[model samples]
Target: MEIERKLLKRSSLERLVDMMRSDGNMIYAPQKKETQVVFDTIETFADMTEDYIVSNQSPKFVAFPKIEKILDFSISQEGIRQEGTQLAAFPPVVVLGCRPCDADGFDSLTAIFNWDYKDELYNERLKRTTLISISCAQKDDYCFCTSVKGHPGSTRGSDILLTRFDGGDYLAEIVTEKGKALTEKYAALFEADPGIEKDKFLAEVKPRFEVEGLVQKCMGMFEHPVWIEQSLRCIGCGACAYVCPTCACFDIQDEAAVSKGERIRCWDSCGFGLFTIHTSGHNPREVQSQRWRQRVLHKFSYMPERLGVIGCVGCGRCSRACPVDMNLSEHLINIAEV
Candidate 1:
């Protein structure tokens, strides 16, 4: 699709932020929290932090929260009652400053949520949200979006993409109907595209490895020792999954006092030993090695085959957050070579 392009001055960008909030849209952007940069709710443009290469966590939490109430149940003398979150009650939101990897990961998450069963809450939230991604200007050893067919300026799951110019200006690539509508509504804030080149300012990320035939290679390595040797240092911490943008595994729990309770849905990780445990005291992924295998296979093999989309977005947050310095790129390269 041909995207609409526009030029926005640094000061005008702040006006856009004000306009979205004045129109009653919830804005989520990067903010400086202590030492780390994180995606958080912002009240004004002044609250936005512009010094981060990437956020501590992905913007997925805006649509798929870490903790969500699935339904509330009540018991009375007459009968039992249950109520669920209403789709109509959801508020509109805008995710700003999302990286390309983070925004593109939404496609993988959407496929999983709308797969066999439609998750009403996730779908509802997605329908009401607009993603505005910023082209990456900085990348590190941990970043490798190119290997996954993604780029620093990708617009896969973004409504709009903003690329910085030399003079504190931004080039806006309106990629979707939602983006066009927002620009049309706030026409005064945007200027006609002056045909300025955007590639000069965008980050250049080298591909880590080729994904072609990688999934097929993984199929034969199910019982390979690489899985065990590579994952031996894993501490069973769910930090990698938590920081991942496409990981959608979750667990449901019933919280009760006696008569009143709520069924809650919380994030889960395949790296955890008990994630696939059965009630009969048997676990499918009994060791860290097996659990690690599931994580890699699901991202590189299962999701791509089933949904036609790669689950990993190459954000590198997992590698950054890993306590044992488990580099994802290294593991994948090893597997591909084997």
Candidate 2:
């Protein structure tokens, strides 16, 4: 619980990256891919994108991949053999330049995975990864972290947090024991903080809505026309859930050869028509409008009631990725007003 502050020079970041890699850690940083910025496995600091507000994808994939192997199986002459998931095999990771919203979203993911049954794979990766989140200096209109009780410089799930200073240096907040270990191990890279504050350069995001009773309001709106109006243009591509920081729906499948096979879990979306189809061929959420209502209610109502945490972190990637421009903030604000 000891909060340590330090100063990091811009030039020293490359050295830090080198230090982490030399320590047998995998580095995940934001990289430029055409017009989008993505968090990718990086070997050097030069591979990352600078001055980007948010990544096209969340760092959630670092721990919970879009597709992951759950079990490997083989059939023999006598019987069947299966190899289960191994916790010791997960590698140590250092996530650099993670935004505050994405870091906070990790808490929601952790809550879900560890809720009823402990997911050893995800927990192992979570334990092994150290987040070095950078405060947002720039944001677009789509960004609304404040609406979800998050801030640009908040340290919810990050181990270490970095904020840009006036002189191109970074003000580092060692938020956790892991972060403290990292700074102490690489003590040469960070200098004692000279009382410089982080607020000067932090991006200011206004709250989009009064979220107090919105979840309750959503229940009343199950039959409301807003769902139809809002989701009419939805193409059901599931792009929003894919880019979301806290969407955790997934489908398990067994991919098999003649004698060998693997059980894998892949990302799924409630936005899709097939998400809740019964085995008897009855779909509760048969239409796009009902499916849209499920997304809103689950995030705002069910998650909060069940997990004691709001699901959305308000990174705004869903709005950015949606082809129909289904702005979540606008829709939520409308719901709040209703």
Candidate 3:
């Protein structure tokens, strides 16, 4: 499936936006405001900005949503009426400029949504959208995808992949059938070029982990002291779950306004003190240490032991969103020993 093709230069990102528009697809990217890049729909060429580390929030919400209105219930003189609502229409969507770590999180998350309960809403939206994953040569201290099982120039859940070239050009690689078709449609925008530097390009992108023993090593430690030491500063505010790319716990409640009441499911977090509280005024994981233990166990041990795949994407959103600066990678590295 390897093919040599001319890539889009840094200057031609505007042209890519035009390609998205002409094909009747809705494009969502890291749009530039005044100083920062936020996820939104672009109007002109000025909105496309992929230079930021990661957004304040993960792009998962753009597809799954934080809190969604599934249906409406009304009680009138005629007794009661229930009005149902399905997930939105399957609009052709392009989640442009998502990184390799950004895209891999979705593949790890897709399992939970499709396991015992088939969430058609999440799956349908995913089916329609195209993820353009990337590999960043520029990384900081906290960007540690290599530790577990991730790489900078990796193709995880990307339909299309892009790598930064030496002279402002991108090495565009198609990872899926959808990406191949999309590229074929925009064939005029690309040139068929023979790549002479394939080995050099592959050498530039190397995975950092000896992934064979990671899961087994992570599975053997349950009562390890690192959980207490690592999570000592945590306050259990649930902010990590709020900003996570793969944390999928939710709570459903009935909202009664006037005459109409709707049953809604909103995102919930295991990190919150109230998350494990019983109706009899008893709480299990009232302490932050216990909550943090659950976080690691769920990602490394419980999830892998049960679901066959780990629960984290190494996106560092949890670490980024922590008020006390509780870094996940720093903590996980300590646990990697056991």
Candidate 4:
């Protein structure tokens, strides 16, 4: 679809931030923290690094945190009673300078959270946030976003997309109603640039993503020896699952000092041997290879087959976060080519 395009000069950085901040929105962007690029609240557009590389942690942390507190309860003498439970409203948020993969991952996440359970907390958080994807001018060797129907510079689930053209000006495309509302609110910061058409800038986007029957092919190799041989040296740790953009498995626990406590949710991983251990120590998936196979299957086949779309965003964080060097991209490409 041809979207309405606008122009924002390099000087408009402060203006954009001011506009968003005026509405009590939290603006988060990639900030330089020593050697790594981390996402944090940015008070100004100067904090936005246009040439910033991939963030050490995918922006998923902003949506579903590693650990979260859900509800709290209190008990005295009479009976159990509900205590302070209502959370503060999530003010408007703008995730600025997000990549296409990060944006798509969040969109895919909405499905499961809103499935049968209907998580109102997560839904509320999402409604209050706006995703603004900034086009990537470069692609590293480890990037495989294109393989899963994603691209380095493409915009899929963003409310607004910014494409940097020649000179210091950017071509902006309003992708969703949130983007329109934001643009309308900050109309003075923008000017219609006729030098470039919407498609022209998008034409230059090159993501080496190859989405064939890669996931399905991985499905075919569920019990194959490759898993056993490749994963034999792997230690049963949850680092891979912990760093993956699409890994949503979690365990909820309640903590109570006396008769009442708070309900908490935290991340979980299949790599842990105790993940499937029954009360009687009956572990169906006892080996690391079996655990690893489950990871591949859940990401490649199970999620897509059930959700009608790809599960993984191909962020490469799993490979980067692996302790034993269990690179996911190599395994995926190996199965995909076969």
* Residue 129 Cα positional deviation in candidate 3, in Å, after optimal superposition: 0.7
Residue 157's lDDT in candidate 4? 83
Residue-wise lDDT of candidate 3 within 7-35, one digit each (tens)?
76666656877878777888888776776
For residues 1-338, what per-residue lDDT tens digits would candidate 1 score against the true structure?
68988998889889999989999999999999998889988988899987888899898988899988888999999899999867788899999999999999999999999888998799989889999899998998899899998999998889999998888789999999988888899999989995888888888999978886787787677889999999999999999999999999999999999999999999999988889889998998899999999999999988888988898988999999999999998899989987
Off by over 4 Å in 3: 1-6, 10-12, 32-36, 88-90, 194-214
Error of 3 at 101 (Å): 0.6
* RMSD for each of the candidates: 1.0, 1.2, 2.8, 2.6
What order do you get sorting by lDDT, best first?
A: 1, 2, 4, 3
**What Cα-based lDDT does every candidate model obtain?**
0.91, 0.90, 0.73, 0.76
User: Where is model 1 poorest over a 10-residue stretch in terms of lDDT?
Assistant: 212-221
Shift in Å, residue 320, candidate 1: 0.4
lDDT tens digits, residues 1-338, model 4? 45667888767856888778877889889888887777889988887776664676777766777777788888879877775434455667889888778888886778778768887666777788888887766656566777778765666888888877777677777788888888888888878864675444443333443555665576577768877877887897888777676778888888889777898888899989988999998899988899988988887787787776677877777777778887777877666665
The TM-score measured for candidate 4 stands at 0.90
Per model, how many backbone clashes are there? 0, 0, 0, 4
* Cα distance off (Å), candidate 2, residue 212: 1.8
lDDT of 2 by residue, 208-235 (tens): 7867678677657778888898899999
